[model samples]
Target: MDKLTVPTMAELAAKGESPEILFWVGCAGSFDERAQKITRDICKILQHVGIKFAVLGTEESCTGDPAKRAGNEFLFQMQAMSNIQVLDGYNIKKIVTGCPHCFNTLRNEYPGLGGNYEVIHHSQLIQQLIDESKLKAEGGESFKGKKITFHDPCYLGRANNVYEAPRKALEILDADLVEMKRCKSNGLCCGAGGAQMFKEPEKGKKDINIERIDEALALNPNIVASSCPFCMTMLSDGVKNYNKEQEVKVLDIAEITARANGL
Candidate 1:
């Protein structure tokens, strides 16, 4: 896929312009190759919809989710303050993020520290664009009748009560969207939450991700969909552990929307 050339806030500000939304590319979106693809796909969507969006680029930092989760309040505050300074400098109000971890921190946790903004997950932005008719299946209907099951990210679903935005975006694909036994408010984690992704898991009879994947496999989904990049990693690892990589695909919601829209 050709890469989309996304602009930075500084570049926009140099021209005395401001974007409608600031695209907050979290740590994974910046450093992880797999997540980077999702970032590009989301950029394609924003470009396709003609939405003026900008990133912080080198100025963006971690949302301190891992630090706070790892019991490092001091570090979390340090990181948050730095980011808040940069954002406030730009007078940014609306922000969109592809990672639910960032979404959770920015929307729910940043206010107390004087960092307040209307933060939205990428899925929510995509759903809004589709609803407003800014985006559509121009080439053809993609994933029509294909079996798909969504694995809700803990941060995006239960934490923020954003269960419908993702599903609403998938509904545009016209796919056979299925739900796991545990979904929405009762969703299961992929074992990487609470800073677990950075360390080895303690002994458990069954891995959380494997357990979640088992439920997805039972549904025989053609694609196991995810919204968060961390969930994408855990679920893909789970599928590969079961030697089902070829049979099932683990994709981000942004990737699916981009492909469906022929971006």
Candidate 2:
């Protein structure tokens, strides 16, 4: 991957000439090409609707969510502190993140490091945009014949109580929604959370994500939509590894939203 280039929150604040919002593109969004595209699309939607926001790219650094989940509290603290210093220098008071893990960490964990800021997941912001008439579903396209299911990321649903925004986004797409047996607050883990993204999964009866994918597939949905990049990556891999990729597609909520918006 190319080296990440991002402005300090302060620099972005100065460039915009008015303090408004900063978009925190997490490590996955920064490193993964597909995730980056979704992040850009979200930013475009927000910007087109008159929401002033700046992208904090690689400069935003890792929120150390994986480190914290991996039992490396010291490393987590160090990373959190470094991020706090950067945000403080920029005098940033609010942030929007594309990745759910980063969203959970910034919103729930940063205060412990003496960093307090209003943080929002992209889903929340997008929902706001829709409500304010800043975004609207394009009229001509619809997935009338397609059936889809949503996989709630633990960090987004259980961790942050964000269970509606992505669904609302999908609803606008006009897809036939199928509820998983284990969804929402009782949702199954993708086995990629708690820094499981950084390490190999422990040997178990079955891969947690594979099990989750199997559940989604049993419903015979055309797509598996989720809000987290990690979920997208893991679920997509599970489908491919299990030789079921042809039967289902994995997409980020932003990607689905963009499609619905005709972007």
Candidate 3:
């Protein structure tokens, strides 16, 4: 693989260059070790398809999804305002986020606070790329006969109604795409929403992620695909709890697409 060239928005600004879109590397995508790989694959896809994109780098702050979800509206607004100021300074008009949490807040909540931009989730962006014929998935590793099931993140599905784009991205692989009994608008959360990931379950009969994984495992999928970083972590942990880590793999949509496209 060739070395990846990821430019920071600051670098682009210094050169009087503007990117087609800003890649918002959320908290997980930046700090989480596992999620960093997903971030890189997302970048590789953008680079492979010649999409001029740049990360905010040090200028970027937390989208405050967790803070907002945790009921700290004041902190959330403060973070949002700071981020908005930086984004406005750079004149960013379009943004794509690897995490659904960031995607939701940036697209929906920010507008009320004076930060407006055309925000798209990575899965949506991938579907767009496929539709444009820029990503053929022809020269990459074959998922031709594999069974893959996608776990919808709460923020991406029910909260925002972005259901089809991700499914469409996976459909191109000619793989067996199975749906859980509760999916789409009826999709179950991976137990990580509403800042739940930061706390332990409050004496629940069963863990939500475990139940979700049970639904996916029932399909006997070879791989469990997820679009959100929180879902990835929760689903992965659930898989481990079942001792099925070797039998089933958990991967992000961007990672799957990157591997399938050999990017």
Full-model lDDT, candidate 3: 0.94
TM-score for each prediction? 0.97, 0.91, 0.98
Kindly indicate the candidate among 1 and 3 with the higher lDDT.
3
| Tens digit per residue, CA lDDT, model 1, 1-263 | 34587999999999999999999999999999999999998999998888889999999999999999999999999999999999999999999999999999999889999999999999999889888988776574479899999999999998989999999878878789899989999999998999999998999898888999999999999999999999999999999998999999999989998888788
Query: Highest lDDT among the candidates is held by which one?
Result: 3
Off by over 4 Å in 2: 1-16, 139-141
lDDT of 3 by residue, 1-263 (tens): 46899999999999999999999999999999999999999999999999999999988889999999999999999999999999999999999999999999999999999999999999999999999998878778999989999888889999899999899889999999988888998899999999998999899789999999999999999999989999999999999999999999999999999999888
**Clash count for each candidate, listed in order shown:** 0, 1, 0
Q: How accurate is candidate 2 locally (lDDT)?
A: 0.82
Which of candidates 1 and 2 reaches a greater lDDT? Answer: 1
Q: Which pairs of residues collide in candidate 3?
A: none
lDDT of 1 at 150: 93
Ranking by lDDT: 3, 1, 2
**What's the CA error at residue 246 for candidate 2, in Å?**
3.6
